[model samples]
Target chain A: MTAAVETAQTTTIHGDRVSLLRVLGPAHVWALGVGIVLVGEFTGWNFAADKGGALAALIVCWIVGLLYTSVAMIDSEVTSTVAAAGGQYAQAKHIVGPLMAFNVALFLVFAYTMLEVSDAILLGDTIVAKAGVEGLTHNSFIAATIVVLAWLNYRGVLMTLNVNFVITAIAYVSIVVLFFSVSPWTQGAVLKLNELVTPGNALPYGWIGVIAAFQFGIWYYLGIEGTTQAAEEVRSPARSLPYGTMAGMITLLIAAAMTWYVCASLMPWEYLGITYYPLWDAGKLTGSPLLENLLFIATLLAALASANGCINDAARAWFSLGRDRYLPSWFSAVHPRYRTPYRSILFLLPIALAFAFIADLNQAITFSILSGVLQYTFMSINIMMFRKKWPLGSIRRGYTHPFHPLPAIVLFCLCVVTFFAIFLGFGSQLIAMVAFYFLISLWFHFYRYRFVRRGDQFTMPWPKPQGY
Target chain B: MWMALSYACWGISIVLALWMLYDWFKVDTTYSEDMLTSSREGELEAVSEKHRI
Candidate 1:
């Protein structure tokens, strides 16, 4: 193969060719994964309580946690082997085809962008609530937060990771504090399993309520997989990716359990069901203004941490696609001194700001979950495909999943169920997701027939040349 | 029926969480070392081939 083809196949940053610096370590990876989903511990999952009561919501969270665990296991193996910045997108390209790859990239970008916008809005509202500033508009705060996060991201990957680490640590410690301070176990309150099932009970809505609550329950573990996007930038991804993802998953599971248990037990399920911010309400249940204030700060920190990680993940996804010529080449440009994807971060900043101002948080979250479920489905399918294409002993294996394709298959099935549940729960958002996919498909087909058929330079980088 | 399902889900999640923790601590790091070594060798070989060309 010619040098040009080799370069094109191996590396994606062309024209003003630049590469990403491997600055992230295992601890950073853990923080990235945990930070992206830590906000779930503060809010969002309470909607599940509304749907299915405390016990039912806890059950749904448990089920979703298992689904994410299976996904993490499979993804660990795939990321260890491929170790690309594009992450699931790159894996899809190699295992499936370019069409699936493009679709996955679009889904990732949509999911992370929506998450970023939603978290920014949540952060602004949290700050206003903490300050007791009535009638103060949060839109300005949202815009300011977006700009600051974008600037921090552009400064360098290390700075962004360091900030995320501190914010994530605070967010996690707050959850532990909340659990110990208010939970029935620590509060000397009577444990009542029987009351959980009494007529007009905690689960007054019934089994259907459990199904209705699945989407909200999913909040606890939604964006953890985005950590793998840093695979190329992490030191020894083969080890760190698995270690980081698994550790983060375990932490999230514990946090989810503690949050659900504490919030559910401290207050009546009926009351917890209606509150938008359950953690804040849990603090209120303590009848202590100081604890409420601390929980308020924790809520803001959680939102900021989640938003920071979303920016990091979204920018890398955009950078990878742009570098690979899936998107415009300008997005691939790395800052000369900082070695960061400044262009892509700037490009996404305005969009996030606009969405934060105008979009409804509930709808944005539903859409984000929709996109995330689709991405997980694709990742699971790609894992199976990779196993078939390159069997266990065929490639220089890093960390092989213990059960081969079982975990992948299970994850795929769970994702399909979750997709249908989300569609049923949020019909309008499902329609929007379908329309978005349709538009993406049209562009992909047009690009393939128009540019690829004509042998243009802008083509999908797949069926990678030998020895790449 | 909902009660049974909730209990089952909780059981499964606890088991899964424990298994993940075990796997996280027990999984070997030697594989990553081998991978890094082999990747460096591959890069060197590629450079040598480029020079010959």
Candidate 2:
């Protein structure tokens, strides 16, 4: 039962080495990324409409889209080389130092965990609202959703994400179907384009409001970068990571456009901004019970799909922390039979459930958005260090991002703008999140640094970093 | 009826959670630390050694 320290030479162990199953391909990767994000199109993104107007929300969507495009390109390049479970945290360890890597891991864990919480809560509330049964609360349904998804993740990633693919695809098609069903293309279509141009509907709160709207614009593509979390599990990190991530990004952009058009065209900006279920409301406007029922089912499916992917990702990031001894090594163990991170998956379940039970939806979404934006800020720095330390031709890269510094620069600038936008709305929460991470950084520096094997942290067999 | 269904949902979830926790501790005891913390990244490298990409 002695723990073997990793070394330059082999330290023989008594039992067979266990690893996560490398069965996932590009489709699972697409499902993993999109499944976590498609739910936003169904419900969350319209809050942007509330802040500014429908036009401002649409503007912010394209701007934030640019930010995530940079994220995808930079992530695809680094993950192709690193190919580990923790995604950006793994990249941070190799590119930056251990302290930054620790924080990035926390960011990934909290961001996904909080998103999972909100998704679960949304599922509970949605069911309760629709069921029309007095005395029924969301507590049981919330518990059931988190437990069932965690169980699915515990069984294996392949089936979990395969199910995500089907459900996510269906949720996405629900939007497209609503779009075609409304027939905005025809002259006598049902869409009210006049509502879009109404006084104050274009920019109700002015330029500052447009800036504030950028925060909610993130909902459109919040967890798309999570595709990188599957790096270790994917069969071909080189081909699959970029293909799945970029394809998922394209799907999101198209979905976001259609969602905004359909929702904004059907309702006034004031109401669209405040509505709980924008897509479902848009379906109701068509006066079709069939589309309403279809959207209702789609909303539930989207939430389930999102919560399922979050469990997959949050567990992986936490598992990576355990594997690296950043947290307790006990959390690192992979199930021999299922080849999944059973301990990490179990560890996050209660934490998510507790947060789902108490956390306000807006607060949960805000924290998730802040954590995600912070990770993108790290990506800018990580990519710059990656190119400088390794340079080109230093090692084989599976996918190389075009226009290197440009993407990094754009990603950083957009992250700053998004942070400012978030500050305008949730200034206290932004400051509070920073203070929390800062305290954790201090704890890691003083208490946790001793446990980490610094040499073992850099796992890749590349030449020595240049000018290091 | 709604109340009964709610309780049933909660009961099923709690049982599932308990089973996972039980399995978690069992796996910890059954496996060695070396086996659990083994470098899967190294194994991945070995598998793709012929083609580094």
Candidate 3:
């Protein structure tokens, strides 16, 4: 009823924990969100063209873009309000229960790690293809990249932020160059939208193809919510969280549109679909080897930047779960000097490498999107629960969703659609996702449930701060 | 029918993006300076306490 009574939830963790240094500002947070996702603009989204052709892929892109917009809006409201290092996991703990929190943590880690693994593999494949390196194994390259990223992450948060900002800037600038160089406007070609619908072309696979395209289309915005994992390191979580997320989403949306339009217009959908690096291929269409080489470097940088952010997010989620005793307490250990989550980052490196070796790019993308949608569904539900549990009048809030329940409800329905897309399009991967959920639930019942000492609690500090 | 649906999806997406942009600038960014700095120390202390546990 009262603000004090509403904020009375237990804010303590029982096990050993280490604080993350708050060195990141709003710009760094934006870089983390966009950098984790910018690679999709360069490579992955073209896969949708194979399934649905240009027109259908464009349609799917619009739908998926809207879905992520809803996700970004709702996540901005919830993350700013909760403001914890755990990100979605912490939000789940406060609004749902520990069981759901455990599940969300696992899903978040799975999604980010899978993205990282995929990027490592893709970067290796790109090097081999672009550099004409003979007999170089993708496995070796992926292993080496993961090790390098892990070391850089272990150094310190500031170094990681600085490196991410530089790589993210290069990736985005490359996209802008691609847009100008290959765009229909620059080439003096009108977009023949009708040409995409020629008999056996547009929806070659029909509505099923459109559904299939959703998975790849989602890659454009998959990692934006990851910015919230930086809550602990952000100077002003309440203000920075929303600003970074929404701004990142807007930038990605524009980038996605430019990418899809330019690539689809410049090249045949069939050729674009098969290429490992679509932006590079699009640059090739301009008959400039120089632009192609530049795009090659950009694509590699995008993958590296994305892998960097993925490691940051997945490590934080692991740290949160470990701190709460969901996993072993050893994972909660922070570097003595760097103050980084060294243990968790090291723990994940081998698993990520192994996943990279076995999983193909398409499988990795679908798996990541599927796991992300699962986590987001719970996040949407948690938003509604938070509002009902602590109404606007009952709590000191910095930012709240303007439409409140509408955005959450929309996000839930969109997530359901995405689930069906992944399920029907990639049936085998869906089974694996189910198995993962089962195993996580088993662990929760056998071990984690016992260690859950706290109830539904919102222990974040409230009231009084402005302009941070 | 598919063409019609595609157009509709594009239209709705455009509207949603515009609405999100408006909400970001109008509602979320309109917080007072008091709300931003009110519990700065308390919030940081709470975060530290959570970690120290």
Candidate 4:
């Protein structure tokens, strides 16, 4: 109280402050993170099985689970203190320099936007498959999804995430329903245990196979860290951010395990790896129209929930960047009526629509995953720098992750292995993305930095760094 | 039949997008930059009892 009051007296009142609505609780944060990721269980994760085998995919699932647990801890610590909309991007700015923040903001934008695009495409495809109609263009469904979800986001954060919670809850229930329908408890029931030990099924591609599976392993929990993006909007960031994030991580780990078990036992690795909707396929294997219908509806809801979450996160990152004058200051404006980042939300709609229209689902997902991997890699460094600059007791943290540097080191090493896995599969695309970011960094340094408010960028009122 | 559904979806999307664009322009024309960019975070922070270092 004394320090804050003193700082307030010294600091200038820089006009009125335009901010996001801080109405969210831990539940909204959980919805935001889990909603963006639950869709992955339906579609993209099976690609890991395709790369390696069912056993390899399961191993990668747990490995990536460990990777994301570290992420949840590190992010919860940093975001609880930072309390900003851009999540890791905001953390980078306060802890590292502005250049790093700019790149991190881009990573958030692209990662979520690409994921949004993939979700929209899957939504459209699910509808198409359900209808089984000839000459049904997916463009309309994709466009409608982007438009509708962007509208939800532009309206308000509370409504957007509240809707996400409902749909995401239903989608999760669908997974549980599928798990129960198989009767895994009964001896010699629906599950074929041979799927695990069959020749070439356990480790189809050997060591390289497990490494390659790492690329798709992320699908099990891609956007759980996104819970922090709601930091600026949450009612109690310190408590809510960590609680929501850790809960979401736990939920995802359980969901991933159950999804893997049910799907792997129901189908052979050869078929499960290549299938688009492993859960839905498993539903079909039950020979029950009711289960199949339920799974299909569940997939649709998950896609919608994920797309909605992606739009919300990407727009917040863009809005934070705009607020800092990294881009046009005009984009920072909040809707007076709704208090939402309306302009930023509108700005990203076309970008997501463009990708949804042109890019294949696998390509869009690969790009999203790579973008996320890059962000996590940055996070490992960001947290270490944060501690060195302002060790413990220098500032108040909402929650402190245990085992300090261990999580950071583990996150870094896992990120390196994941990158190697991606390189084995997407070497050319990885190179292209690197080149693209390099070009953009040059542009930001030479051109955009002039527009940024350097002195005003540091919004937190904590004391200066040790050396500074 | 599905084509009709798709076309209807496209039509709804276009209409919704146009409305948003109109609202965007309306909001821009209606409000000043100062008012639009004004935030409540600083005010709340000042009055709050939580003592952040």
- Per DockQ, the best of the predicted structures is 2
Q: lDDT by residue for model 3 over A1-468, one digit each (tens)? A: 243222221211212222567789988999999999999988888888887788777897788887888888888877876777679988887677778888898888989999998899888788767645455455555765676777778777778978999999988988888777654564345344345446678778888888878767887788999999998788888889899899999999889988888777777788877788888887777788888888889998999999999999999899887766677665666553356776687778778977888888777877788889888888788887777776675565556777777778878887877777777778888888889798979878887678744532346554422221
A146-214: candidate 1 lDDT, tens digit per residue: 766777787788889889999899879877877776544543453343454355776778887888788
Q: Write the per-residue lDDT of candidate 4 for residues A1-468, one digit (tens) a residue.
A: 355334323422333444677899999999999999999899888999889988888999999999999999999999888887888988999899999999999999999999999999999998898788888878999999999999889888999999999999999999998888888776357888574547656888887999999999999999998898888788888899999999999999999999998888888888888988899898888899999999998999999999999999999899888888899877788886677889899999999998998899989998999999999999999999999999988988889999989999999999999999999999999999989899999999999999887888887767788888
Cα misplacement distance, residue A351 of candidate 4 (Å): 1.1
CAPRI verdict (incorrect, acceptable, medium, high) for model 2? medium
RMSD of candidate 2 to true structure, Å: 3.8
Clashing pairs in 4: A17-B38, A17-B39, A18-B38, A18-B39
What DockQ does each prediction reach against the true complex?
Answer: 0.02, 0.49, 0.02, 0.43
Give the Å shift of residue A324 in candidate 2. Answer: 1.2
**TM-score of every prediction relative to native:** 0.83, 0.95, 0.83, 0.95
**Model 1 clash pairs?**
none
Task: For each candidate, give the TM-score of chain B.
Answer: 0.52, 0.69, 0.57, 0.76
Chain A TM-score of each model, in the order shown? 0.90, 0.96, 0.91, 0.96
Name the 10 consecutive residues with the lowest summed lDDT in model 3 chain A.
Answer: A6-15
Candidate 4 or 1, higher lDDT: 4
Q: In model 4 chain A, which range of ten residues has the least summed lDDT?
A: A4-13
If chain B of candidate 1 is superposed on the true chain B, what is its TM-score?
Answer: 0.52
What level of docking quality does candidate 3 show? incorrect
